[model samples]
Target: MIDNPKIKTIENLLLNKRVRLVQPKNGYRVAIDSVLLAAAVPARTGDKVVDLGCGACAVCACIAKRVNGVELIGVERDPIMADMARQNMSANGFTGRIETNDLTNLPCTWETGQIDHVVANPPYMPANRAYLSPNTKRLTSCVEICASLADWIIVAQRCLRNRGTITLINRADRLNEILSTLNRGFGSIVVFPLFPKAGRDASRVLVQAVRSSRAPMRITSGLLLHEANGHYTSKAEAILRGAPINL
Candidate 1:
């Protein structure tokens, strides 16, 4: 019933049933970032995972599909999204395991280095640009007025076990910045480039790293998401459909 396009929200299906996010309309809603971020790293059974800045719970839902039985905690700075995330998890039958929280409000048990994996697709913009939505919540989703990349890395590093993996997706041009952050906080880095189309410059990239891995960095075969005809590449389709991407 809402007609505001600038509202930040989405209606999606994760584990089958329909679900809604805190987003209203016309705002920065869920996009391919959710899929790309979830698929960037391999998940194992029983992993304790956290999704930083989990808007509408899309990434967390995607992760739940990839790694069953993992303990998932969805962190959202916005309270409305927190409620929506809880609904999304409930729709997916994970109301108990996939719950809402703010890192600042986390229980002492969860605040420590107890998580086995951390994933994020954080805001790409700086803060408060002319293009930012008038809706305060929508604006926060796309800009970093509240949390920064460094803050995310710090929280992830602290929450993860010694070698827990942290996976993220961001603009391709930000690769170096991401690499720098990961290198400073963790090791065993892996990078994947995601192109908008064949022969085009990569527009997005996925990066993963282990908390204290000693292995050398590996840049895997980059991914192409579309063909010149604007059709989804088979590789991209597979990933979007919850298929695994080889590291």
Candidate 2:
């Protein structure tokens, strides 16, 4: 892994944490949704956790701090991000629990039911609608390039064990697509809508589904992220800050 490239960008962790990511200004950068997904991941001691599309390995870093006893593996399609993820894993002294691997066709090395939990913050936009980056490597992994949502979900299904949980964050308008895909494979689902503030419609949603469960879905109350004055609510602050969010 090449050394962590010098960068000037800053990333805010929702709360205090050991792993602080120094985002490279030029490459693929992670966003608040990634932080939310990482914090919301249901992890248990010794759980085998895998992150799909781990840009710069940031989610794994946050997971290292928030979740205990999870042996983390980050799967990236881009070699640059994959290498950067390796370096990031090493830099944060998480080499032992975290590792990076690139499989152009995701779920390449994983066997059925091997993973306990899988988390993905997929490209929000569709391929044709997104603008390609000038950088080819960065282009390949982002939705702005053309990684299909179906491809990502199929890979997630292959890697997760029966009854394993799959968590995802996606654009609010795409909830129907995400739910349809999950229902065909896994049954039990919990969807939480995320709103920018009270009285505003949610623009994003977090989905949690278990493989092969036939239970009814439980939709949680909307998670209001901010108030009218741009202040975080108590519940929103808890999840954003990496505190346990029990819903």
Instruction: Give the per-residue lDDT digits (tens) of candidate 2, residues 1-247.
Output: 2344443344433345566565555656776777788877888778888888787787788777777667888877655556667777776777533334443444466656798888988878776776877866456655535456766677788888999988899999889888888878887799988999888888999898889889999989968898889988887777666775443
Alpha-carbon shift of residue 94 in model 2 (angstroms) = 1.9
lDDT of each: 0.73, 0.74
Model 2 alpha-carbon drift over 4 Å, by segment: 1-14, 96-104, 107-109, 132-146
Give a tens-digit lDDT track for model 1, residues 172-201. 777887887787768888888888876788
Worst 10 residues of 2 by lDDT: 96-105
Error of 1 at 244 (Å): 1.9
What are the clashing pairs of model 2?
14-241, 113-161
Clashing pairs in 1: 5-25, 5-26, 6-25, 6-26, 7-25, 8-23, 8-24, 9-23
The candidate 1 region of ten consecutive residues with least summed lDDT is 1-10
- Model 1, runs deviating above 4 Å: 1-10, 14-23, 96-110, 128-130
What lDDT does candidate 2 reach at residue 27?
Answer: 56
